[model samples]
Target: MMRKVFSIIIFVFMLSIISTAYAKKVNKEINVVISVDKNRVEIGNHIRLTVGVEGAFDTDIPELSVPESFSLMYGPSVSTQTTIINNVVKVFRGFMYGFSPSENGKFEIGPVTLKYKGKRYTSNSINIEVVERTPFESTIDEGTDRSGKRVDINKMVFVELVTDKAEAYIYEEIIQSFKLYFQKGLPIDDLDYVAASTKSFLAEKLGDERRYEEVRDGILYNVIELRTALFPLVSGKIEIPPAKFKCNIIIRQQRNRGSMFEEFMGGGGRRYPVERSTEPVKLLIKQLPEVDKPEDFAGAVGKYTMDVLAKPAKVKIGDPITLSINIRGEGNIQTIGEPLLAPDGMNNFKDYDYETKVTITDRGDGIRGEKLFHKVIEPQSEDVDFIPGISFSYFDPDIETYKTLTHEPVPIEIEHSDIETPIRLSLESAGLAKGKVKILTKDILPLMTDLYSFKNQGVAIYKRPVLLSIIFLIPILIVVACVYVQRQRALLSNDVGYARKKHAMAHAQKHLSNARGLLQLDNPPEFYATLAGTILKHIADKLNVTSASVTSDNIYDILEKRGVSNEVIKGLRQCLESCDYGRFSSGQLSREQMESTLETAEKVIVQLEKQL
Candidate 1:
């Protein structure tokens, strides 16, 4: 009995030693391990930091804290999980912290400490790199990204605006992607943009949020890419406005290096503003050539095949038939309009129209998708026997011209029914027939003319041969003028350079109008560059030359051979010289001087047009 009592005292003493503040060794040991999804992250992205406290203890769960650089968003969401294996019990207390780094460069998030049962334990430090952008992205940051809220220099995320093509023909399919690239794990409060208006290009999202890891400049960054496709509405230079986004990101305020406990236990991280944007992009969209445009081409672009289906091939008069017209292709399926179901030029079918329901499925390589149209139509008259095949025309971007596809007519056999369907005839609200009725009327002959009441005013000068010849000649002249117009249209439609020459003046004028808005620049470089571009483009279009080949030396030769006045040639030289000089010089120039330069460009083009 004395030995049993002595064993109990020893057991109690051991327990007391294990719980001491300066215990040499802890039998109920908990080794905290720090882990993250990634070692590198962006400011807007988040990382999951788990402080895993693993031990064979029955109790004594440790508390954890991260470094000062990371904004701990959620948790220390504590989970004290226990499991048994091989008759041995294990306990794991995971303290997970969702944090976003607010600073850039390398940060050591460690020596996180946990305190339990009067003892303190420290975890191994984790090294992480936080950057404004991916290592692969070298795009410089702009001031436009700053919002009203404070920004952490270490934590920066931004959006990227990219277009697949620098130039596109009118109605050509072009992809515009807006990617909100942030660090992985960063929580986005709300991300949104105003829906693009119908007056510009059509915009469609390519896919949902995509997450991946990319290494840029040797730094690994977690990324989320959002994609969109833009189809320009009109020709000329269309500006896709910059995408705007508003967000809130946690900021790990500056604090001491020792314990993470002070921040979480005292006053934790604050939420800061993270607003950023990509610069607006300008797309040079040229007009589709009218010369080779098919008369049937309805401005559809891409490669496509068409077919029409009707539920019931045969129907009685007034019975409805469900028709499905499908167009499947690679390219802008959304731009395809309704098919002309009555292409046989027969009035047999009524105008049945509907919106094209497009299913844009992006096959791993590119957009190979389909569009469907469903409509219900009834036979207007018993005489109509078959639904004529319809024609759909689209410009094949691959072939650089319009191609028409025809869906073969659907045959419908009519069944003649002797049933006399009652038709109701109603008068105005004041006089209406209650029951169905038919009205019958007989034709009446015209009354005799009263010739005695009319008197001749004159001999009728219009009856003379000369006046009659002039009057009769007018319509013939009009017919000839129409023929000439048709021929001109045909030529313009067929020749690309000829079309460019025709609209070159108008195009140059449009560019000048844009430069007019730029005249407010306090500097001279942009104004001169724009002014020079307008003149060069005009000359290229007029002379059927590429802009790159339209140097002043070559331009002089062209103008001189075309017999432009030396004075006009000199003015052209002066304009080019002024642009080059203003582009380089930091010299002060008045707004009036820039306006004068603009005038010189316009006047030079007008004179050259008349001369050459």
Candidate 2:
């Protein structure tokens, strides 16, 4: 037993030494590479440029000396990758950018340069050719598949941006959709979408992504679609920018030599990245007509009807009466303001600020929902007999006219309050006869007459050493507590990172509780989304970075660098991927699966708390 134990100790020591040597070697090596998704693109199209650094986690962003003809669209989406094989760990960081060319010409992008640990590394330069936009019909080409089947390459993959109307009134609901078409049997993954710019409109996601199969141009294809409801904010000629999408197409090839298991798995495949962009769309927005517009119109544009109700028809004066005004039937429900109450009719009531709640539902066609307003009003006097009528006005885009809906006054009965006021009186009002004061037998009791009572029964508390020590410690404890509170306040005010880290766990717990509540509702998508957000937000707070920029791709290296265990890291990755699947996939998850996911997430977070 002693010899076996000695061997185990020696083995552990040797393993540690080897790990340290490997870490040192990794720290000494650094590599930088820069590449673009495409070397040629049309003038209106954009290219993705990526700068990758290996063997290092912290490095300055590479700067590209862009030419005057090229414009930067969006950039520097950071992604981190970490891989461990045979106990060897490798770290990589990537920075990506989208660049659009203004004119047709050949341009050189870089010999990108990066600075790391006081050393400079350079990458090879890339040449890009920008050509004029080609007509859609002329862009199609014929190609052959692996089985020699004739295929239209352009028709194999494409994207389209469609709107229900090319022209609309201001604040009108317009359904805009983005559809991606790919050949039915082609394997596609890693879809990165950049939505069209909607700076001049109010946009809301309609619903979950729509997936189905369709036949286009006599070829069967699978389609993935996303929908948004947009309301134009201003009236004028507006040009909606083109939407961009990038995805990878997997191409399978047979391997020369491999194990039977590998062969059964179909060996491996290469990914071919493809990008597509839709043509720009122009829309003409007409201003709302000013003819016969309602005087109380609050810029509401939609079809709506109002219902006003007052509860508790019988009440005493000065008692609160709740007025529920519900406006239902669609179109920018969130932007709708509170309905106007007749001022003259409200003279007898004491009105307070009203609260509003909006409920919106996307029926896969357009935005339809209701806004409810709850106003509390108290009758000032018994003379008030009825609540005033409420009115709401909106432009009917279908009829091209302004319409007002009014509710009839709701009658109520008010009675005098039952409680009576107390009467106030002064000393003179009492009318009491004045008389000379007679002294009582004695104002104070005589001092303790018994000598035994005066004898000290116990030592005085102030005189005893133990008691005095306890009494003196009170102020010391108070001072210490005050100092601690002041230091905490100062830190919370001045140190952002410390404050975020301090509240990170509490915030995560709160969100987790909310997710738990969602679990009882049968809404798997929302529950998983909330759970995933909680984890990402917790890590973001710990690292003092924005939650929007934290993704599964980069989280591995981040946690690994922070010394998180491999088991916990893998569990976290699984949780996030499961959440992504639950959120976007059309299939439903079983209750047991959801419960297990939630448990796994909780465990991962608890483990992270110990290390992070």
Q: How do the residues 1-612 of candidate 2 rate in per-residue lDDT, one tens digit apiece?
A: 999999999999999999788777566678877766556677766777778788877688887767788888899999776654445678899998999898998888778888777888887677888887664442322222332212224655899998999999999999899999987556665567899999999998887679797755334568889899999999999989999988766454433444433232233445567889999889999998888999889888888988888888899988899999999987999899779898898988999998999988655788999999999999988888788888889999988989999888899999877665333233443333224232322332344345566756887776799878888999999999999999999998688678888888899899999899888877787799899989998998887764533655457888999999999998998998788778766799999999999999999888887889
Q: Tens-digit lDDT track for model 1 on 68-135?
A: 77787787677666543333446777767788778788887777777766677787777778887453
In model 1, which regions exceed 4 Å deviation? 1-155, 183-199, 246-267, 270-275, 316-321, 329-335, 342-371, 374-386, 415-612
**Candidate 1 Cα deviation (angstroms), residue 549:** 53
How large is the C-alpha RMSD of every model relative to the true structure? 25.3, 21.4
The candidate 1 region of ten consecutive residues with least summed lDDT is: 439-448
lDDT of each: 0.68, 0.79
> In candidate 2, where is summed lDDT lowest over 10 consecutive residues?
142-151
Deviation from native of the Cα of residue 229 in model 2, angstroms: 0.9
| Candidate 1 root-mean-square deviation in Å | 25.3
